[model samples]
Target: MSPQPPASAAALRARAETAGLHLPGLILAAEQLAAQVSPGAHGLRRAGPGEDFWQYRPASAGDGMRAIDWRRSARSDQDFVRDREAQTAQTAAIWVSGGQGMAFSGASDRETKAERARLLALALAMLMLRGGERVGLLGQRARSGRLQAERLAEALVAAPAAQADFDAPDAGALRPRQRVVLIADFLARPDWLPGFLAQAAGLGTTGVILQLLDPDEESFPYHGAVLFRSQSGALRHESRDAGALRGAYLARLAERRDWLAAQAGAAGWRYVHASTGDLPADSLTELWQMMGR
Candidate 1:
């Protein structure tokens, strides 16, 4: 699959500035945010000049003149200088739910829940990348780089997310401080979330989860003998007694919802809960603000 088109930070910021016009009060600007997200040892800096010494290279066009290290240039007797950049203020890792059950949410207009997930994934990735934060895919393949943000969108567009092994900690050394932003339906209580978050938190990581709930998910709205298949997570059922279990089902769903919120809150995680056809950016900002970014 192809990585997303590489849009300059300015172009991306401009797009985000105008994206949520459909919903008033939902618009936000990530441009002014400081770089603090680092998911690995290398500071997650934009491929431009800032604070940390990311790498050095011979001076070239578009390279900030100040980035040239004169001492190195003198030694080589060439135009060589240190290419310093800002420390990644945040590591915005995105977790998309591709559990088998996510497919239950049927298509709308020309899009299915899968497409919506991809859209959210791309939009948020762009927002974070635009803000100069390091953005990466979580469930599918996690990566962090200036242009790697676009890879995530293309992956989502090319394939549905594979089931996430939340228990498996991400590898590689990230910046000491990082922020993780998750987007998922969280349908099944998969046995992986707590472990993942704990590991990241150990490294001074904060989290934000955008719970994407489908309408039918909250309600066992299906009646009659109906067969269902799961999307990413493992859950299958052909309920004949759905009517009788409706009350218990509702109660259980409510309990799960409350528990999820409490868990995230207790862990100092920012939660942005949404359903299909809903707005996600405004709440995303709220979470970014909460981490003191």
Candidate 2:
């Protein structure tokens, strides 16, 4: 993969302009939705070095004087050792498919698959940040906090072109023991998935795949005199009657989803499907619940 495009001043401004119409709303909605989920739900619980107070235990042999809480010891008449919760934040590597197919939207009321996937990524990042976890784009290094989300969102929108039909992310970018989330239409025949999953497993990275599809892509609700144009504009198919293709299309879609689920299981990851028409908050909530578990 080529080096990530630097976020120069011009590049940042162009990214902002590219997403100007959607950015504000996306950010606000993400913040509001993330606020609904409590951070403690995903916090790591243990006793170790940390800032938050956990509890006090009776000081024992080998305990250093610095470990004793003098104030607490005076009150209890016994030497007490301060213990703090070791809240180790997890790293979540996130990816959104920017395939040409993702630009397809079935209706004016709904956002394009790419738009919905990007917004979902941002929203999920907000939730992870609030939970005290680190987040990064799949090919990038992870970072924590709200500011990182802004930086990521900017970079996501700034990329000049969509990924190839079956381009897998660079697994070398992933750190061991990290969690990953991928949001994509999954319309392409994925020849690269098995190798990618194998590498991810080798790196000790567990993952979740969020399959986002447009309503029309799922239902195939079209009839007479239908013409379909490929998102890449490389092909066109015209049909005297599109309804005739519904059965086969639906079957193929089901098979694809099933294969995705099975492969995710084999790789020790979970898969979830969401339609573009559904509430983004609901998907975000479900993902958070799954990660916490």
Candidate 3:
């Protein structure tokens, strides 16, 4: 197959602007998030096949001469063996939607959903790295170590906004038994989600959906003569009495969540929702526990 063409500079600029792509702030947030989580919070307790030092044991006949920790052995008459922590790192694939809808932030104090998604995505990646897990974007190569999150942030900012549509990830490198986390507003009805998730499960990928919502979207807090604009510039609707639509709007929202949750459950995937006003740490902590299970 021919190689794919690179995205235009204009498209890259648009995605960054819409997503409020701030690398410095994102890095800081990821670091802070890492600090908040207790070390090894992701159920990574076993010691084997890892880089970090675990413990040393007395040398046995089967032990290789090279396995001896000479520095420590010199301190004692008996030979001791060196052992590294056993690595049980799993791959976590993340996708934070850069859709135009994610650009909407209802209040000045609130962060846009896209920015919040990126923060959570990167922060989670940091946590995964600390746990000795491989981290990757949904359609990208997996990586490990402390700096993987930084690289992901750079790639995220460079992606074109037009590529934000809900599409099944290219699973060429996606192996069986890996985890996939999808962060999105999910405002539109995803008729394809059920099949996509089912196929993902068939491929041995467990899924997690983090549905982001704006506070105003959940509450429909507007009253009297409200003009609502589509973030994608696809539609415009004026409400003479926005308050009147609250009941139907909220009902529809609830219905969507219900449907999504049901589909996720059927595919053995986890579903969680959060508002932009909610602290990212809380949601991430919850997600960590879920993924651990």
Candidate 4:
């Protein structure tokens, strides 16, 4: 597939200025992506104390007499219990890392990690909203409806640039039993992560940690006489034979991914990995399934 054309600075600024008045291109793209997935029974069609009818099943020993549909039961020899669809909307908070490292793209044709993260976050939020779930930024209150999706897009566009090389999730923003989606490249191993996961477990907050990386970061395609610099220019390394470091670099990357996966599992959450080169819709499909679970 052809790469998406980069947005001009002037156009971006104009879109930001008119954010609330109309849907931005980013939101439109997210909507298009979200529309691709079918919103089939998204864990909301379960039997519960809701107004809408879900299904009818044979009455069991524990089934209360009030729940028994006598009208329907009369037609059949066995008694049936009326089940209603669960109407409780789940709250989801999505966070994209605002780190300097996220702004780096390996090539002009590829999107920056930040760009991909925001797109996925917004698209996932749109899908959840379509499934009758409330969504918002990590630090904000979750709300339902199309307006909330628009507000999430606006918030993502207006987010301030990063001043640091890496960022950690805001544990204080988490609420009990709230679902969260955090998208970031954990190259630096956020020192706050362990504590955050512990707190999330304590509060019963389940979530998914998505590790997004640039193709260059994943492959480390450097050769002789290379200089590597952090996105913030806070750190630098020069190597006469950069290709020789590939083995060590890849090993560390794998170790980090394993560590993250273990942490997520320990906390009853899930871990997902994706690269900018992959299709956003593919990752969104996986996220949709995880959220439904």
TM-score of every candidate relative to the true structure: 0.57, 0.78, 0.77, 0.83
Off by over 4 Å in 4: 1-23, 44-59, 64-87
Instruction: State residue 256's C-alpha deviation in candidate 3, in Å.
Output: 0.8
Instruction: List, residue by residue over 1-293, the lDDT tens digit for candidate 2.
Output: 87776679668777668676665677776677777665553544578767778788999998999989999999977999988877678898987776788888999978898777777788788878877788899878789977897787776676555644334566677778888987888877677778878888998888898888998999999999988887877668999999999999999999999999999999989989999888877877787777765
Worst 10 residues of 3 by lDDT: 162-171
Model 3, 1-293: lDDT tens per residue? 98655677667667777555577777887789867876563434464566667687899998898888999999999999888765576888888776778888999878898778877888778888887788899878899986787788887766555543343345454568788998888888877677778778888788688898988888889999998888866778998998899999999999999998999999889899988887777878877776765
What value does the lDDT take at residue 48 in candidate 4?
A: 82
Q: List, residue by residue over 41-99, the lDDT tens digit for candidate 1.
A: 33435555455666767888866777678887887867875766655445656656555
Error of 1 at 15 (Å): 28
Better of 1 and 2 by lDDT: 2
> How do the residues 56-144 of candidate 4 rate in per-residue lDDT, one tens digit apiece?
99999999999799999999899999898886778889989998999999999888999899889998988888878888999998999
Of 1 and 3, which scores higher on TM-score?
3
User: What range of 10 consecutive residues in model 2 has the weakest lDDT sum?
Assistant: 159-168
Q: Pick the winner on lDDT between candidates 2 and 3.
A: 2
Model 1 TM: 0.57
Judged by TM-score relative to the true structure, which candidate is superior, 3 or 4? 4
Off by over 4 Å in 1: 1-88, 107-110, 139-149, 159-175, 232-235, 279-293
User: Which residue pairs collide in model 3, if any?
Assistant: 47-86, 48-85, 48-86, 48-87, 49-86, 49-87
Instruction: Return the clash pairs for model 4, or none.
Output: none
Worst 10 residues of 1 by lDDT: 25-34
Error of 4 at 105 (Å): 0.5
